[model samples]
Target chain A: MVKQKSLRTLVAAATAALLLPASANAETVKIGVVMTFSGGAANFGKQIGQGMELFMQEHPEAFGGHTVELIKRDAKHPGGDVAKAAVRELITREKVDMLAGFVFSPNAIASAELVTQGKVPMVVMNAGTAWITKLSPYIARVSFTMWQSGHPMGTYAKETLGCETAAVGYTDYPPGKDSLNAFQTGFEAAGGKVVDAIPMGGPREVPDFTPFFQRVKDAAPDCLYVFVPSGNHAGAVTKTFADLGMRDAGIQLIGPGDITQDTELQGMGDDAVGLVTMHHYSADYDTPQNQAFVSAWKAAYGADSTPDFMAVAGWDGMAAIAHVVKTLDGEIDADAAMEALAGWTFESPRGPIMIDPETRDIVHDEHVHEVVKDGDRLKIKVIDSIAQVKDPCKALKIGKCGE
Target chain B: MADATRARERATAHVVTAHRWRWVEAAPWLVATGAFFLLPDYMTLGTQIVITVMFALSLDLILGFAGIITLGHAAYFGVGAYACGMLSAHLGWTEPVSALFAATLVAAFVGWLSGLVLMRYHGLTLLMLTLSVAILLQQLANTYSDFTGGFDGLTGIYFDPVFGVFEYDLWSHTHYWYALAWLAVVFVVARRIVYSPFGRSLVGIRENALRMHAVGAPVFRRQVAVYTVSAGIAGLSGALFAQANTFVTLDVLGFTRSGIIMIILILGGTGRLYGAFVGAIVYMVLEDELSKLTPEFWEFGVGLALVLVVLFARNGILGLLDRARSLLAERGR
Candidate 1:
């Protein structure tokens, strides 16, 4: 049995050798992108890939004549096992210079130890857990954290929306918990009382929010803040709220922009109208940079597939990588790359953004937008903007984020 | 008297051959030793393969030798992982060896309890019962998020160096050896069990339970015993995974995992001791390569490979090799 297996192994190794790419050029920078490229969340990977491609195409000189090679791997699901294995292979065999693109927080959290051990600088594109940066010193986020939007939304809910009492419904996970804590802290600090905080369900599937919504309706708070993940869960929460007629009861529906994601907005119909959210980027932003980005995205991916915050994060993440590549002159070192990324600021399609040196997390503008009906389609109308919002979980030294 | 003496002589020879360590049996160990020195970059994958082989070996004990088709084998694996993870993360029991033992014990106790109920059923009903047990555990783990970490996974698990000498290096050289050592020890014990009189009795029961019962072999008791042992070994594999990865997730108890291991066992050929080794290496390597070639739909490649195995090598890769070897010998003659 062993001898036959060994023979088969030799055959396989020979085949792999034949398929192996030729030796890398001196200026080539390989970035291994690990994301959910298959399964239900495949769109996250697609959007992020498009964003990276767009940035590279638009800024040809960004890498300073170095050829950028992206080796993409499918994480498949929110479960971290596949992602962990993919990262290991990328680091060990492929010997990728940098790592980017994790759609799920669990996947990012799982790869933290590997990146630290491998001494690879990881640019997180879209995992929102606040404490992820604290896991590895070689990590930095181009994406926004839960606390960045959730904390400000909490204050906005009380002072701007004039909601004296509120209820928060969050998907039960790490990011969910972080979102809940951030919102509650901000709300209470702004003199608003939290009537109820319910963990709806896990983030693996689109959970039915009927029961949770009914519970919130019973409490009858002035406003309801929810934080589910940004894909199908958001649609379910919107449908549930509409079905339950909570808005008719004069209870304001509010959350982070996950509920009003651009790609999901039109499908939500007018039911999404009057739903207010605080978030980083929106495809409908009227700014010149954002309009240009939206047009380029529509041109590339088709008019129907709107780019969401994940895409923006992917774009900004690539920009950060490009910045590192340029500053280091294509000689990528983990410590040097991280140093170049620290306090790096750029005018993004989302407006001005920076990597906070202290926490190694993104600092960006948080826009409070209301979903409004524009002709036959729903649109995001920015009502308020809070510039340069840092992750409050880190800023306030809350829980594990302080460590 | 002459016929009986001849039979006794043949039986003694069989026992001697089973007891003796064949030169061919040492080949895989030598290959593993070579991989440690030569394939330094692949040590992490090597460790994973070793861990998987251990898990598959445990499955072979009951599913192959005892004919107990369990779909929820991951229940024991998940139990072991969580037990080990909680030990190190919550209780600060960072010692790898003792923690593994404790985790294995918990999984065995759980298995023994479940085996009592499982021994009463067979076929589809038995499969469903096992599946339900795994699903129940998964739900319980998810609901009690404060303890298990729920879907986000349990982190902060750190292990001390093995025997306080070899640290788990970034290259995973130490991890490969540590897991390989455990696998070697378990393989020997498993080989012994499968070749013993009790092991023959399991094959007897698998072939015909009624006949074994008529012969007064206490079928149910033997089945339960093998299951408990299998579950313990599986738990040990899971503990190794948790310790090596230093993180535990709900995927440990996932349905996909249980299915994947069953497929691996069938692909290597059941009722063979070394089948686990061949199956795990093939499946894992195939997955690694296929995913790289086509990241979006890599399962398509894996599915194609499995279909070919089922159609051509019905008894699996080992059975195919055996047939080819015999054919060559016949031609030589």
Candidate 2:
């Protein structure tokens, strides 16, 4: 009877040992990454992934003794249902601590419900629509929003660039619409007249931008302030502007950060030279931190592979995660991480980046830059700056903003 | 003795048919109901699969049984989604029952109108005509950003509750059952439609429309009716999608969406009612699983498998099962 009792006790002890590992295995902080790593917007995800890798390699101690585990799932750019499915899988299946990465607003909106419902702290890496921040309480953005950079460009174009009458054109999509509307709001608010707002094709359609450019030329404004998102549109836009001879015609062309992205500069060459645009980060930032980041990036990915603002935003996302680990003593708590990120201010390569307490969006400097030839490579030269831009959507009189 | 012999033969034949068909028919639904309890953790993905199956079923009704090819079935889907989205978001129609009916009617109405033009063409012309309508609607949605919420998509929309009892949540526990019930209802109605004298006529038209016309079948009118009915089902699927996802983007109306559904239908083997469910389950689950397994996952394995299915199992996965059943029966005899 004593031997039987000992055998029963051994069985019970063995069962407990098997179950304890699962509960006690909380030493690793896992970030579920749902990004458009495939499909049309692959570049953004690729760059962002690289940026996170660079940060994780350099700052092992920031995790507060826990190993950072990243479980990535592809949202497929512009994928709606897939994004939701990914978030569900991440939260329930993999049991990830936090979530990050999205480039398009549509995908962000789709995943927002799961993020909100699960109470998972999702650090928005690049999706910049103003409405995205309002979706969930647990969401925090480490990237610049369309409203942040676009609204200030309106002011810059009118007050600094001295644009009296401007004709507007934008890529006909959600992000493009937000960027243009914010720019127009800021421009029109500052006593500058918008002659015509010409809409062009989206990613699905290959449209001739020449006609839209011709329409802008006919309007004959002081400058044509347009919103063109990155991808083939930016390349087509720079070529169209050059082909239409708008620069030679003495009508200046300007836009938001998407048009003058560092990646797009490769195709723009001389055409992009003197083309002014507004953005959160310039590759040519002269700060010591930025210099280190650039050097590290160059060392990791040759001299030709440069970093974009989206990549910097991804690095900042990891920085936010690091702060969460530091603040909570390496424990991954959703509520604590969200609370820490809501109004957290940290040193970024771009500068001192602060998340707005009210909106939970990145409140950082918006720089007005002109594309210039720096040696063999073309890069944006920061000419002017807008200090601490908050979300323009929160200040609106109406609209739910998807909340 | 002669009458008794004939009766005995009929009974034996009926039993064999029941064994092959009825049990086979109930298996998928029974397995799905059984899986509901087991797959609690994957309810969201499961719900999405159920919705896609419902969508594929609608396409099978037209493209598979009726022999009509369409590239823009998403038109009805978008219409239904927008109808639900606009009503719930803007007009304050919160009742799920009312919204579903409204979405169905709106989709059917649009389907009827487009059918008038679409039925006049054949082959590529018909395909292009169908595609054009969807594209036009998408462009209109883009142009009137104020109403449809433009490219930002119509946000701030959500379902009230299922029968004012169960509130839809992120876990999709209630949604799975709610959608399953709808699927069962639609499946029954579709089965009746496809098996009826009218369904036989539609199949006959698919085989040879000219011959069907000569046999006093009103080809165009019958085609229009079936298409409209199919559209209503697709709309219901779309309305459920809006309810499930709680948001509507222009995605429902895109050519890619239409193309994917078509691929699902073809992959599952067209003409069979059960094909849609199998196709959706296999496609969606594989897509969800494959995408997670690797970074380079692009449904390439799915594409390769589809090519193999078309080359080998001409009818679909169901066809392979049908062939196996017949072979087993032959051996048993």
Candidate 3:
């Protein structure tokens, strides 16, 4: 009897030890982030990482007394098989509680599928592919879809700029197509005609756009819409356009946030002047939240931190995750965390951001801005704000968007 | 005199004898293929394997049977992919037929064009020329945003069913079967070519180009022809890939893609037709598993494995299996 009692006591002790640690660790949520931290997209990833780090530094605790841990994997820029492999690794090996941060749509789609199949909650940071919100409930995005800015940009081009005919040129990819499609739909709806739509490969190909520019110039469109994303590509094209004296020929250049935030555009000096773009946030948003973020970012990264739009996206993503965790009292259950995130609203650097209950995409404002020289530095000046744009997926009836 | 006669006869027999074919020689490969294909179907690994097999078979024509080495195989692959993507998006052609014609013609044309430059060079020069072609193509794809659909990629491409019978769905299972069938066809064609007189002459050139030239072999023309054919096969694989994923990106033409395909061939033991298939499947599976264990550091493991394979098993997994089989056979004897 004595020996049996002692054995039972030992078993009880072992069970307690295991259970206690497991329970304790349960409160420590592990989130996997896959982003292109190396190669071409490295700058975007670094900005995201920095934003998350800043959020973590401020909040310390994620939420609800839970500790947040991040497992980072580099989705190499110019991503292909390596990015796919990284996503599989994050899901199967690390077994993260949540997955997020695919900057590109291909990587986003690949990672989203793996995470959704694993039944993990995923939040996209910078990728704007409409398919993410439309296809899966497991995904929520803090940034605009590829089409989001296009609608506002189109409206502004017609109503604000009073442009009658707009010629569109973009890369021949999903995001480019989606953006142009959205712009066309919105531009046409606003009684503006899209004179021409030209598709190019991504920034890798340094295309001689003399023919394209000549065609657009010959068409004599009131506004020229361009959507080249990469810095080098954007700069080269801007220079080429400037060199051809297209600006002087009365063709106004307009595009998305990528154009305004591109370092290459800044380097273009006088070429970027008077170019209009649609974006969610600019470095000069004039909000306390934005001011604090800019201050923190500048302090952390140095004074020459030419903040890209991705920096704001990264900041918003981290803040949203932090807010949800804090509201839940540090509990890390996927369903509960998702529920908490649904109704959550937070002041982001880009004004007020709230998770749309139906689509799970963040509902925010899109701004139309003109590139203006502010004291020696060129900055985007907001001319108009398209407030409270809902998730486009809501209209498609694909998900429970806007719930 | 009798002993000398016996020695001469032995030497003559050795020269005349061809390599023996055995069921045992194929048993391990058969088992491996069965395991890789059948087992992976249950896990959805078969789709990737099937695509990779097609990629390898395409390379086999140029690298295995022919003495040509290309570092820009993915250029043709990307061209095929883009052609299919463009045709499907613009023409709204059905999947299989479009894939058949687009992949073949585009890849053949690119290969033929490249062959002019590639055929002029040999050794590392050919490799560099192929690399330049790939880079140039990638650059063109990126620069001409009006056609190639830049970084955002061509989206929402819907492929109609094959002959209105088999539907092209998003589920990767259908893709597995389609790719597998194509791979089989490519394999049969490759096998026939490798065993034919043309194949023997190519091998002869590989062994002694000077001797083959003296014997009046049009070596450069043959090399170019084989390279073009190989490119068509590679293009076919790319078409299937574009169809399967319903998307095509610039990454398809990237140099790293060509490098990975070459690695697969080397890992499986090049110069053997079946080695490409085996190597591709094994490399993908290892990559899948390794990435699951440690996402960030999996490349380190892959690098280590490559080093070990190079140092100890020079002939690759197939060579190791052959050695093991020989050892067991000797013991049995």
Q: Write the per-residue lDDT of candidate 2 for residues B1-333, one digit (tens) a residue.
A: 999999999997864553244655788788788887787878888888888888899999889988888899999998998888888999888888789889989999999999888987889988899999999988888788788876667877877788899987667888888888899999889988987778889999999999998999999998999999999999999998888877788887988889989888777778988889888888887777666665444556667778888899888888888899999999999
lDDT (Cα, tens digit) per residue for candidate 2, span A96-199 = 88998887777788888788778789899988878787888888899977787778888888998999989888778877777778888899999999889887
DockQ-better candidate, 2 vs 3: 2
Judge candidate 2 against the unseen true structure and give its global Cα lDDT, from 0 to 1.
0.81
TM-score result, candidate 2? 0.91
TM-score against truth, every candidate = 0.91, 0.91, 0.72
**Model 2 pairs whose backbones collide:** none
Ranking by DockQ: 2, 1, 3
Clashes of 2: 0
Per-candidate Cα lDDT values, in order, are 0.88, 0.81, 0.73
DockQ agreement of candidate 2 with the native complex: 0.42
By TM-score, the candidates rank as 2, 1, 3
- Which regions of candidate 3 are displaced past 4 Å? A1-26, A77-85, A111-113, A209-211, A262-265, A323-338, A391-403, B1-18, B21-54, B75-198, B207-250, B253-255, B263-333
Docking class of 1: acceptable
In model 1, which regions exceed 4 Å deviation?
A1-26, B1-21, B325-333
User: Candidate 1 — which pairs collide?
Assistant: none
Better by DockQ, candidate 3 or 1: 1
What would the per-residue lDDT of candidate 1 be over residues A1-403, giving only the tens digit for each residue? Answer: 1223211111111122234442243376888989887767888887887798788777756766566778878888777777887898899888999999999888999999999999999999998888899999999999988898889999999999999999999987777788889999999999999999999877777877999999999999999999887757887888889999999888999998877888888877667788899999899999999999999888887877788898999889999998998888788999999999999999899999999997889999999999988898888999999989999998899877887
